[model samples]
Target chain A: MPKQVDHEERRAAIVSALWKLAGERGLDRVSLRDTAREAGMSLGQLQHYFATRDDMLVFAMDFISKRTTERVTARVLALDERTPEAILRMCVAEMLPLDDRKRQGSRMSISFYVEALDNERLLSHAREGSRKLLDFFEQQLREAQDRDEIPADRDPRREGMIIMSVVDGLTSYCHLGLHTAEEALAMAMRHLDTLFGAAHETKR
Target chain B: MPKQVDHEERRAAIVSALWKLAGERGLDRVSLRDTAREAGMSLGQLQHYFATRDDMLVFAMDFISKRTTERVTARVLALDERTPEAILRMCVAEMLPLDDRKRQGSRMSISFYVEALDNERLLSHAREGSRKLLDFFEQQLREAQDRDEIPADRDPRREGMIIMSVVDGLTSYCHLGLHTAEEALAMAMRHLDTLFGAAHETKR
Candidate 1:
């Protein structure tokens, strides 16, 4: 159990190194040798955890995606008012690149997104993650509808997809510096306000 | 004059080759040598047109952006009813990867977008294009508001940005095959419906 814990720690360190390199330079510029140097390990040691560049990328993406889910879940659980509408807003906010750490996460996700466009393994991995998020959003929308917070006629699945797209688009613009993170979050709030009915003001 | 024309043609041919390679293998995998070979030319010939990989990428991006603008313009002009709603829908449809050629274009753009996250020159180039597009969208929205087609209280610039973001998010999803082109277009139309008011049914 101790050795297993050590292995996990080392892998986490390498992935952290990968993120550092990817954040400063785009993900495409990352190489195993450079990552190993950044992690203060030999290439051979890095290879023990990741056999190839793709292997390293896939592992890094999984790590970040899981971490993001955990972070978002924790934030939602700690919220004072966890109405369906509030929960959805919290999730959307978490998805946006609102600060430095979140921005780096967004950058890494965007890189993987582009890579996923052509790589089957990465594409499936991304799709699975997206599917899970969409299902969760749909569930929240359904809950809102049940509580009469949103129109009953609205399709939860479609609404969830639109919310996802808006958040994604805002994230892209934020990364490009075309819109500030604050501006993006405001836009997302506006969209949610329209969806949840103008009468339901956010308690936050 | 013929020599100048030939020079332009050769550059076009090279860019075309780059697109083909990029569309199939992703842009990050493309190299000057590979592009030259794909174009049925030599490395020297390719280097003559593009001194560096960045030079090639910038040129190719410019070429593609110009072509996309011209095509979208043509489609908009051909529309029978050029209302703000109609025009915006047409532009959004053109932006989506609804077919083979467009899918390839989106793939290339996505790759460039990732690159632009780190490269200043490319970032500026991308921002310039996005600014122009946003301005165009805002103008259309302003006209709509003036005509009382959309609510006058809505901010034209902000609405334009939201439209752009929704379309962009949909485009990314479409490329990933998470949503078919048709599904993305439907989702975009729904957003427009909500924006333009429920009474304004799309002519198309």
Candidate 2:
């Protein structure tokens, strides 16, 4: 059991190194040899954990997605005001690159997304993640509707997708420096205002 | 003058070949040599048109941007109903990957976007294009407001940015097949409905 725990720790360390390199240079530029060097390990040792570069890439992507979900869940649980509006805001905010850690994560994710466009395996994985996120968004919107927080006529599924797109679009622009993180957040809040009605504005 | 025209044509041909390869494989996987082969030319011949790979990339990006603009312009010009709402609809529609040719273009553009994130020169070029597009969107919203098409209090600049983000987000999902092109179009139209008021829905 102790040996297995050490093995997991080493893999985690290697994935961390991969993210660091991927963040600095785009993911496409990352090589197993370079990642080995970044992780302060021999190439053979790194290969022991990940048989192929694709394996490493897949593992790294999976790791990031899980970590992001855990972080968002923890944040949501700690919120004093857990209204549907508050939950939706927190979820969207978590999606954006508001801080240094998130910015790096965003960069790596975008890089992975581009790579996935051409790779079927990666693309399928991405689609699965997207579906789950979309479902979660829809659930939140449905809850808001139940509480009469939003209009009865609103289609929760479509509205969830639109919110997803908005956050994604804002995140991309934020990375390019076309819009500041604060500006993106304001735009998202305004969108929520339109959805939940301006009269129910949540206090900061 | 004839020699200059031939030179320009050769460069255009190379860019076309690059796009074909980029559409098949991601842009990161494209190489000058492979592009030359794809163009049915020697590497030497290709090098005569482009001094370096970066030079070729910049030229290809610039060419795509100009071509897309020309296509969108031609499309809008052909519109019989030239209201601000109609124009906005057309513009957003053009951004979507509703067909094969556009799917290819979107794939290339996205690949270039990921590459640009790590390349300073490419990022600056991308930023310039984004700024211009955002400005155009703002101008359209302002025109809509002037005609009393949308609410008077709507901030054109912010609305423009939001619209930009929505379109971008939808485009990305369309490529990933998370949303069908038609569904994406409907979502965008719904967004327009909110902005222009449902009563003012333009007759298709």
Candidate 3:
């Protein structure tokens, strides 16, 4: 029997190398040839996986988001039966760049954001990803309100926007060295507590 | 007598053309040759003002920041004898991309931010500008506390950080079309009111 190659694994390896190069230099330095060199693969092999540079970038961003979602899922599962506030706090904290890996992810995200400003395909992917994250947070906030874990008067949509804004903002600041990862997480936690904890306390 | 060339005006024109090109295409597309073409100047003439690509980018970013500071100063001056909260609210709202001009400024900022990730000289300029903005907010917050305009127990540093984070976050969201500029300004205003207005009201 002929040996079968793991295409998914190969692509993942390419993305990993792409991120390393992007982090060391800047996202501006990423190119199909350079990515192939970094991945130790021939340009033909990289082209076999990613048709174009934008395709590779889109895949890289998707891969990062998927990895983040997996980590978030595991954290949520570990906190089984926890309050909505607890789950949200965990989710938001995990979304922050709390480690080297996540910081690199955040840098990649900034590149995506800046590129999306002028690239339609990348812009659509970014918008879709942002919309999904916003929707997930909105659903959680709505459920929290329903359970009275958060105040009933809270607007899930608005709060969702706020949560997303805070995460993005803090991550950027953390990347800039204005704040440490620990401080960013702590500040996010405090913001959440003020939003969820204060309302519940006042109601009680 | 030779015609007096306005060197400052010439540089401003180059920076304006830079922003226009950067806005239409991604920042990566910006080059000395392209910028010269877009600005309708010979490459040699462009080199007279900007020796390198980095030099041009640094100059463009500084020009944007100086323009913003000028607007902030004008707004503050217009609100003569206003409360700290009023001045701050105005400043925060003004900092957001509420119109075409400000949005272009924000786009340029995002460009600088991404480039700064790898370029040390640009990164230092970005850091210095960020520090100055943060310091300005901290000073305003401290003055507010001293004047009893806000709660005495408020932490100026923390509040300043929160305000900056919120402004930066909202601006990014606005750029992404996640929220309208009006909504972004409203959210930021509400956040500021919560921090300064509510506490002082209760005290009274």
Candidate 4:
């Protein structure tokens, strides 16, 4: 029997190459040929995976969403007690670009986001991804309120929206060199501390 | 002498055309020919004002910074009382894309910021603008502290950065359709309220 690998794994490898290229150069400079070259695959092979630039872009954007979900899921699973503030902090931190890999991921996301502002298909894809993330945040906030981890009087949905905004805002600031990843993370954590009450205080 | 006007005014008109184009389409779609057509000027005339695409981009970015400063200046001038919270609220609100005109300005700024991740000249231009805005926020915070408008224990520079982050976050959310302009403004105001204490309480 021939050695076999999942087609999804192979496709992800190609997408990874494209993601790296996107970080090094702007997304505008990417082409099928360049992507093929970066991926160490033949042009014909890349063509089999993505028929057009838009196809690759859509796939890349989707891949980014999946990557983020996976990271958040892993973080949530690893938390020991699953306290509301702990879980929230872990989830928000994962959303931020706190390292080189995350930073590159964020840059690609922003590239697609700006592109989506003009492209309808990309816009829909971007919106779907955003909604999914917002849903996750809202759900977590609701859980915290249910557990009495935070004040029940606070509206989870509104607070969820604010948390999401702070993440995106810090991401933008980091990209512009206004804040380092560490500083962005610290600022975000401070916002959380103030919102949920300090971590230790909430834990008690 | 032939009829003459300030060269700066002519350049500003050209920049305005580019700004409109950027809003209608993403910055990636802009080109010299397209900009010339949009401005109703010959390529030669546009060239006389801006020698290269990069030159035009830099000038356009500078124009954006100047326009924002002018708007903030006008708002400050019109204020009846320049208390720290009042001034800070005005500044943060102005930074947010709370209406169509401001939204377009923000969209253009984000487009340039993404481009700047790959382009150094644009990065420098963006950095300068961000620094100016941060300086304005910090100065207002300090002034507020001096007047006892807020607690003196708070670090003005750090608080200034946090406020800036919230503004960018809300702006991104507004663009993504997660939050309406009014909602974004309200959320920002709420954050300010929390940061400075409730309106009357902070006044005391």
**Which of the numbered candidates is closest to the native, going by highest TM-score?**
2
Q: How many backbone clashes does candidate 1 have?
A: 0
Off by over 4 Å in 4: A1-5, A40-47, A198-204, B146-153, B198-204
Error of 3 at B175 (Å): 2.1
Clashing pairs in 4: none
- In model 2, which runs have C-alpha deviations exceeding 4 angstroms? A1-5, A198-204, B1-5, B42-44, B198-204
- Model 1 C-alpha lDDT versus the unseen true structure: 0.86
For DockQ, candidate 1 versus 2, the one ahead is 2
- TM-score of candidate 4 relative to the true fold: 0.89
Model 4 docking tier (incorrect/acceptable/medium/high): medium
Q: Note each model's CA RMSD in angstroms.
A: 3.1, 2.9, 2.7, 2.9
lDDT of 1 by residue, B121-173 (tens): 88888888898899999999999998888866578888898899889988888
Better of 1 and 4 by DockQ: 1
RMSD of 2: 2.9
Q: Which residue runs does candidate 3 get wrong by more than 4 Å?
A: A147-153, A200-204, B147-153, B200-204
Chain A TM-score vs. truth, each candidate? 0.91, 0.91, 0.93, 0.88
Residue range B32-147, candidate 3, lDDT tens digits: 89999988999999999999999999998888888888988888889867777778888888888988888888877887787777787888778888878888889899989888
> After TM-score superposition, what is the CA distance of residue A16 in candidate 3 from its true location, in Å?
1.6
Candidate 1 clash pair list = none
- Candidate 2: what lDDT? 0.87
The most accurate candidate by DockQ is 2
